[model samples]
Target: MYHSSTFFDLLLLASATVILSLLIFLNYIRASRSKPSLPPGPRGYPFIGNVFDMPSCREWETFTEWGRRYGPITYINLAGEPFVILNSLDTTLNMLDAKSSIYSDRPTFPMLGETMGWDRGLVLSHYGERFRSFRRLLHRFMGTRAAVSQHHDVITRETHRFLVRLLASPGNLSSICGGAVVLDLVYGYKVKDHNDELVHIAEVASLEFSCAATPGAFLVDSLPFLRHFPEWFPGTGWKKLGREWRADTYKVVDTPFDYVQQRRVGFTAIEEGMSEHDADILKWAAVSIYFGEWRGSDTMVSSTSTFILAMTLYPDVMKKAQAELDAVVGSHKLPTFENSDRLPYLHALLKEVLRWAPVTPFGGHHRLMQDDIQDGHLIPEGTAVIVNMWGLLHDENIYSRPMVFDPERMHLADASLFMYIAMILAVFDITKAVDDCGRIIETKAEFTSGLVSHPAPFRCSIKPRSLEAVSLIREANLMEG
Candidate 1:
């Protein structure tokens, strides 16, 4: 009986040991499965990473190639900071729009934000209560309903002036019209020439800001602690440049806004109640509206120029759009905002222009607010995420003949472009030039490469489509009088 009992005790000990081992193995398997790996990317050097890979101009093309090589989502490290370049529209919607809560945060720029005080603007503000408030206030003033109803008269009048100016001297109509519209809307101030005092000041500030804002443009952005260093410190020339930019920035941000406040043309959020020196960040929201025009107006300018280039390059598309305008608006009068719904082709042309030559090609990079996993790949917090707006728009599968400019894709749209383009086309017929032999000279519609892309200055013939179209202009002017 003693031998039998000892045998049973050993059997029980062995069974317990087996159960413990099995449990440990199961836990290890679970942990391994739960952990995610980082997405694939090119290997970087020891310290300085993919810095040399980025070109100051047309970095979008390089990013596109990386996407093709490393898959839809490509990862790269710029120095110590990691970046995840999203290459596809599906990923853009899924990551940026769907999971925006984790991705909406803006990256901190030491030079532009702290040293230059540029972070106060809505475009660059951090995703927080302050940015939210700034956005909300802008919605109140410049919302679709308010903008159309409140500023319709001014826009219409300025547009008429632009058409007349094109009639007189058609060169650079895009720049002239854009400056006129924004100047009136922002300050109720009139602008006639590119060298107008207000326009000149705004242009200077914009150039300085663009130069300083380029990634890795100034060492201070990378080494933020350098901003705390004295202005007289060796190799601190960036500080002086920042001061000059600030002065120019204030000229546009304050000058026009002050005039509008004095004239009571529109709502003034700053003069309404908020104190500039208030501890709350929301105090700076109103001024952001003023500074926002630094890029906003230029977007319109670039977009219009692109459309002109497209007209010059693709005469068939231009004539088709013009035919639509002739039928809908007629040669009797210019196109108006009310006629936008009927001019589908013209609307498509505008959409095509924006897609063909995006104003903000790379778009502002978003900083990840928290750690996230996408497609079983780890994206840690503080990773700078580039949406690659241009890359996504130019996807060949989505946009057939993606590089080719076609307007049919944006089917359902507004009539704003219809009015703008129709009037321009009605007044001036765009065509290529002819040599002495009368052979049509092939025009190359090249574009500028920078933060904003515009057509490189190219010569094109701008003549009135018909004598009746010119007569309509005269009658329209008399009617306005």
Candidate 2:
């Protein structure tokens, strides 16, 4: 009161001291409260989090190892983000299925979503009305029963086309087969020329996109603030590549859409109810448009590559498969869906391929819709969840010698009897099994994130179960027509 300046200075000092005391007290309280027992994981450095660590290759292996050391539910921090990896099948069942309502949504990766146009892809869509609509459409188009009923003739014809292409030039077999199937499915056109412009663009665009998407490839994704810079800015290669990819992608997408539109116009004379095939094509086109606009066409392109790659890497699996085809099909004909029932080995082999390397090694990342608790841990809302399909497929309990490419694990003698005898010939011959089936090789991720993760162009040799399998393929080709 005697001196106003002295009083003001004393008040300011008191305020500062109180604020400091409160902060220290809060920190002490936080430390003393039984800290949330997060599942065991490698300790992270302060502030930067786990960004400076976590190896790319064998990440799945490391996660599985941690699960063994810790528990089914585990967590990891990457760039200040928490990733709850469900290690056990039971945990996945509990979270993805039991708590699916809370966990089905895909995490928002600003760089991948807005920058790369993934906000539209099927695999990345959140759990909402639009996602439901797309899933319904896919169900109608490609679900087991629906796909079988609707696309039997088309798929069968395509498979025959695949066999013929392989027989003609096995070296270009992958490109040819993938090109033919994807073109017919998406574009309503067959890839006649090996170097067709559409096919070339499709392959290049898909490959580039995949490369851009691999985890840790783009720093902007981890440090999103970097994306604020202009496209021409230095170190922003992703922006430039993304634009290039979008342009090429649009070309592939638009070509198909335009062709279908033209095709529809040509049949304008037919009454709407008169042509089922026309209506189906129209519906298929709409579905493709919805998927393309939302999810991008890269997954279809990538899956197409996956089908071909599986055959290339697992030659022993395919060789045994061909041997089964030799006995059952007897060199007289190409395998058809009609023979699929008899081709149990081929059927099992297909499932094995999907399981063995799971096109999406780390199941697409999912986002928590709201805060929830599971197994004495807090699953904070918006926590990134990785399905860890790699762990599920390689689980010891699920598959004997999970690492081995033994199609016979899924074999059923009675199941094969209904189709070609060739299906059974090789799987039953256990001696044909390769001693070292080896581990799956990881490929770079694409801009799309989840879909089209191929095994980055690797080589593996094929040895037919015996001379008979090769002879059968040769003889079948020779006898045809």
Clashes of each: 0, 15
TM-score of each: 0.85, 0.71
**How would you encode candidate 1's per-residue C-alpha lDDT over 1-481 as one tens digit per residue?**
9999999999999999999999999998998888997778878776657666655767678778888898888887776777889888888788899998988888887667655767777767889887777777667656566454676666667666666767777664544446555567655677764457777776666566666656667776555557688889975788887776777666766776676666866444245565764323433444454345333456666777777778888989988888898898887777877777788888788788878878767777689999989988999899888867678889987899888888878764323344567678777788876778988877776765555666777766778877887887777766656
Off by over 4 Å in 2: 1-35, 65-70, 230-235, 265-323, 411-481
Total residue pair clashes for candidate 1 = 0
lDDT of each: 0.71, 0.57
Q: In terms of TM-score, which candidate is strongest?
A: 1
Which candidate number would show the highest lDDT if scored against the true structure?
A: 1
